[model samples]
Target: MNPELLIAFLASTAGAATPLIMASMGELVTERSGVLNLGIEGMMLVGAVVGFAVTLGTGQITLGLLAAMLAGLGMALIFAFLVLTLQTNQVATGLALTLFGIGLSAFLGRGLVGQTVDPLPHLHFPLLSDIPFVGPLLFRFDSMVYASLLLVAAIAWMLARSRLGLMIRAVGESPDSAHAIGFHVIGLRYGTVMFGGAMAGLGGAYLSLALTPMWVEGMTAGRGWIALAQVVFATWKPRGVMLGAYLFGGVTVLQFHGQGFGLAVPSEFLSMLPYLATIVVLVIICRNPQTILLNKPMSLGQNFRAD
Candidate 1:
């Protein structure tokens, strides 16, 4: 393969994977806190639309990103209230949240279709970016890519070594025990769910503000679900999440450039490559029940009532 082609492939792969890294990391923490929020797709859609609309109107990317996070935060709050406060079924509520996000975003973005905005600028280092191969590969990405990686490192370290991480893991493992031991299980779960929503929103915002710089209804194209799958693919580990995201990202980028590489595969099959790869990886992972069982959060998707 040509060096230039390899550089482009690697760069695009990192771009494609950035959103998954953000959203999956958020969901990773949420699941670790024993709450299952399936509204990520919905949240991403809302974030995408809101971010685009706001950026288009106000000409401020930062505000748009912040608004997107708040929008997602609001959605998570609703979910938290229903499942945590009212003790509603986690799965049902999550499904409802997704549906609501879809409908709400569609309504909000109705007048904003066919619009586009300037993409987030990629950071350029003066001398380093002028370097031959390493420059384009390492220094040309936007800030979000590096931020996502940093978030992963932070979460991994926290989970492995922080007191707060211990509480979150405890809540996921046994809410009753966590509650009995004087930890506020409900409060902690609320925080994690909200954090997940914000991250999902930020991921969505990235789609509009940086990746494609445009809005389309359901623009996320099931990436939210893929992010959820990635959490499991990584066995709930942050570093593993990064690896899984990049793997999926690589597959996604490949489909776009597959024909360019002289592959004779059908375009339709090429389009299906990312999703198909997801299913295949999931099936292979599920075949080993112990892999899931050992790392699975005990109280995930379960509602807890305080005694």
Candidate 2:
């Protein structure tokens, strides 16, 4: 590949990875809090629809983004109420949430289909955008790309260095112990879940409003599932989630780029690379049950009871 093309490819890969990174990182927090929110895809779909609809109507991308985040938060609250308060099974509730998000987005976006919104503008640093190789790769990107990186850094710090992070870790490990110590387990779980939902929503908005600039049914195409797998692949680490997402993104882009370069691989087989990679990584990471148990949240997917 030409140097410029390679740089461009890397840049596009980063751009593609942004949404996955955001969603996976958010999920990292949710799972860290001992709540396995499988409804990430649903939250993302709702955000995409709401973001596009609002942006089309109001012509304000920021509002659209906020609206998407709020919608995601609402969904998270519902999930929290069902799983945390009512003690519903996390897996079932999460699956229902995904179904609900898909149906709602399809219905709500019906009238808005085929409409377009102004894509989020790209940001160019003064001197940085001019550098030969790094310039095109690092300096030229939309605002969402930068924001995604910041989120990764912030999340890593919060998880590693903050008191709240400790509380979250405590709750995930043993809500009973946390509750015994007055950590307000339920409240902490709710907060973290909402934050995760908001991040997932933002990821969806990045896809619909910024990256693609259009509405399409089920456009996320299992990226949410990939994000869930990434949390496990990373052993619940935020930095690992970022790296995993980019790796998957690179695989995804490689398929298309390969096609562009006249690779003889069948398109169907190429399309399966991301999901296949996910499964292979999972098998490797989870090969040892003891190791997985050591890293996994003790209470993950379990219903917590106050009694």
Candidate 3:
């Protein structure tokens, strides 16, 4: 009810939503090229561990972020090689990637467990950050938070207004047509896949280096899956993805803020709110077949092989 309270809630939602925004946005581009990557969760895990380890070893968050992206890129490259080059089942390969990421990250992170680092600092825009209601709400967040918003805006612009966006959309709709027209389908898809991997890795880094600021084996806790679902729930649109992310973030932050409002509940139930909301939203979006068909990528999840 209070403006300050609302601002705080919204701010928390932004923080909570950052990783999902990054991950889903990445998946969005990947799918825009007609490739479904179910390995997002695993990739995020790898990013988390790699990011934490690098930061721990070097005490440099920037390098840590870079390492995470590279690690995620490696994972994506493997997926692309298998599914695109080798023509493996996209779904199955994606699942394998996820499993490998989970195990590999845990194994690699074994020694780094329990260690912590200083969380990313929030940026303060002197004059702007001092404004009454707008300051903290808009100008006081870490670089990643701002970067996530900018990334969304950039993606929306690129997908809708840019020529490259048109090419990408065309490829996703019909890779055969794209290839026949002399647009290197495989090359384009590879680039998108690597970009997706990089974003997923950044999401993982945000988790370890910002949100929790520590390495806990499998710290992602299914957020990657939620991000994947977000892409579908958003119907492959960047605007929709951002909205869904914040709404989901709100659900996530509610449990923490509930106690202050005297909304007493079991901790377990409170913790389940976010995931529960996710299932509910998915069912809502999925129940209507027309909605799915209206915006669904025609060639999504299908392998494109040049004959």
* Candidate 2 global CA lDDT score: 0.90
The residue-level lDDT of candidate 1 at 50 comes to 91
Report how far off residue 117 is in candidate 2 (Å).
1.1
Q: Sort all candidates by TM-score, best to worst.
A: 1, 2, 3
Q: What tens-digit string does per-residue lDDT give for candidate 2 at 153-224?
A: 999899889999899999999999999999999899999999999988989998898878999999899998
Model 2 regions more than 4 Å off: none
Error of 1 at 127 (Å): 1.6
Tell me the tens digit of each residue's lDDT in model 1 across 9-42. Answer: 8999999999999999999999999999999999
Clashing pairs in 3: none
Estimate candidate 1's alpha-carbon lDDT, on a 0 to 1 scale.
0.92
Per residue, candidate 3 scores C-alpha lDDT tens digits across 1-307 of 6787788888999999999999999999999999999999999999999999999999999999999999999999999999899999999999999999999999999899789999889998879999999999899999999999899999999999998988889899999999999888898899899999999999999999998999998889899999999998999999999999999999888888877656779878988988998899889988999886777779999999898
Q: 1 or 2, which is superior by lDDT?
A: 1
